[model samples]
Target: MSRTDEHRRLAVLAGIDIDNPELRAKLDEVSARTAARLGQPVSLVSMVLDGAQFFAGSFGLQGWLAELNGTPIEWSFCVNAVQSRTPYVVTDARIDALYAANPLVHVDGLHRYAGVPIVVDGEVLGAHCVLGYEPGEFSRSDLEELRRGADEIVALLASHRLPRAAPLPP
Candidate 1:
């Protein structure tokens, strides 16, 4: 599927309020715990919306990106995972052809990233990812930890979703 199609589907499936304090707090806790588990300073439960990559949960983020809780889809690496429905890892975005023009690589100095697709109800939503300012590798075990974190985040999101209405009586 096209990126736009994927994003549109995700936006519909992820109907929970991003601004809900209770949900955001729970997501933030997951991000923080995942960051510690992976020994990374930064982690995010990022959702690729139709127009932006929203940080549904974030840890160790600073400055404007953190303040905004998101960025344009053009600036997002998580979108890669969403599109591919697979993990996206960049050991050094600075030199990676795919990210050479991405603003976050040059402007934010984010050189490393490892992300797993966040799938809920069998649809790819976005990513659960770790960020690093310096170049590095993500071991297989690290990806597994991220996968577990993604599962936890999916559960949190599901809990916040509004229940389906009962079918109308004939």
Candidate 2:
């Protein structure tokens, strides 16, 4: 299967669409704590899917971006984090030519970024991202802490009884 296809498949198998309010609350707590710890204005635990990303948890996220459960992958900076397979940091996207074209950088005003892959069963479930509205440096210790926090988030996900999509009534 194509990588995107496999990602979607594994996401479904891993209960990425879980609707458990209890678990969602925990995820929300994670998001809040991450944003506070990183001193970032926004943080999200996103599930990167085929064409979009669903917010499993979030903090300080709003606006038109607030109205939905997820967003198109093209608009998601965390997509890069999920693909990186390691903690990724963008010191300054606005001034960085490499990231100048990223929609999240130029369009949304999300500047510096630090994130880590959230893995389960050796598959990338999605990513945990801390988005700063201004350029800033992320130290190695900061990145390592982000990775550790991601591990804790993964632990919460792993311990849950994966609730799958229920079959539609005939």
Candidate 3:
């Protein structure tokens, strides 16, 4: 697909609202469906802000998720998505000069990655990404779907007004 088409698709997908209760449920449902439909190993809703990564929801694969919560920016693809403010799709991390040496790509053997940036009101918040153990490529439709999913996640966060949890008095 053309670059413009990709960006436009991302924008359209990012416009979905995930804050509403029904919408949030739908987002989760769709995420699960997408994972199955795409035959991917893992699908996740990730939010990046400042230096932390939050897992709003996930489907497929387990373990290390809790540890990943509130993780630093350096170890995350979501962070890279936000910093670059674009969708990153790596068909083969092992062949990519930039990511080949990255621990997540090398040691973890996460060879394939597809991530779309989540932006709200002109500010990049995080990303929603899908990963696989083997190298793979995503079609335009796949990228658009991922972008929409990410947008829904952003909307969910935006709808909530709860204050950030404060630590108890020590």
Candidate 4:
């Protein structure tokens, strides 16, 4: 099987439903703490699946999309962090050519984004990330902490063995 196929399959085997309301209270604490630690208003713990990204936990996301479950990866900057297996950041999507045209920037008007991969046994599952509407620089130490937070998220996922979550709504 292809690595992509295996990655998707293992994601299923891990059995994390970050969006499950029953699981949110605990995950929400982690997310809220992550946001406080990173000093960002927007933070998310997400899992990448076949074509979309699921936010199992988050903070500072208000409005209609706040209740929405997932979004296509094409609309997610976390894709960069997951693919690289490292922290990815766009300090200013408005000024960065790489993200200048991204739908999250142009459509959602998000200006800053940063994330670290959620790696399990050498495979990237998805990302733990932060976002903001204002541009800001992240120090090397900040990136390191985000990476550590991603590791903590992995630990949390490993400690639980719940049933698989339903796929994102079509």
TM-scores of the candidates are 0.89, 0.83, 0.70, 0.82
Instruction: State, as a TM-score between 0 and 1, how close model 3 is to the true structure.
Output: 0.70
lDDT against the true structure, each candidate: 0.87, 0.78, 0.69, 0.77
Candidate no. 4 TM-score? 0.82
Candidate 3: Cα lDDT at 49:
43
lDDT tens digits by residue: candidate 3, 1-170: 35564465445434444344665565456568667767887777776644566655566645565455434556577777876889988899899877777777777678888889877666665677888999989998888889777767666656653444577899
Steric clash pairs (candidate 1) = none
Q: lDDT by residue for model 2 over 29-67, one digit each (tens)?
A: 888988888788988888877688988888887776667
On lDDT, the candidate that comes out on top is: 1
- Those runs of model 1 whose alpha carbons end farther than 4 Å from true positions after fitting are 2-8, 165-170
Instruction: For model 2, name the residue pairs that clash.
Output: none
- Which portions of model 2 show Cα errors greater than 4 Å? 1-17, 163-170
Give the residue spans of candidate 4 off by over 4 A. Answer: 1-14, 17-22, 162-170
Q: List model 1 lDDT by residue over 46-165, tens digit each.
A: 988778988989999999889998999888899999888999999999999988778788988889999998887778788999998999999999999999999988888787886656
Q: Order the candidate numbers by TM-score, best to worst.
A: 1, 2, 4, 3
In model 3, the clashing pairs are: 19-156
Deviation from truth (RMSD, Å), model 3: 8.7
| lDDT of model 4 at position 143 | 78
Q: After superposition, how far is residue 4 of candidate 3 from its true place, in Å?
A: 29
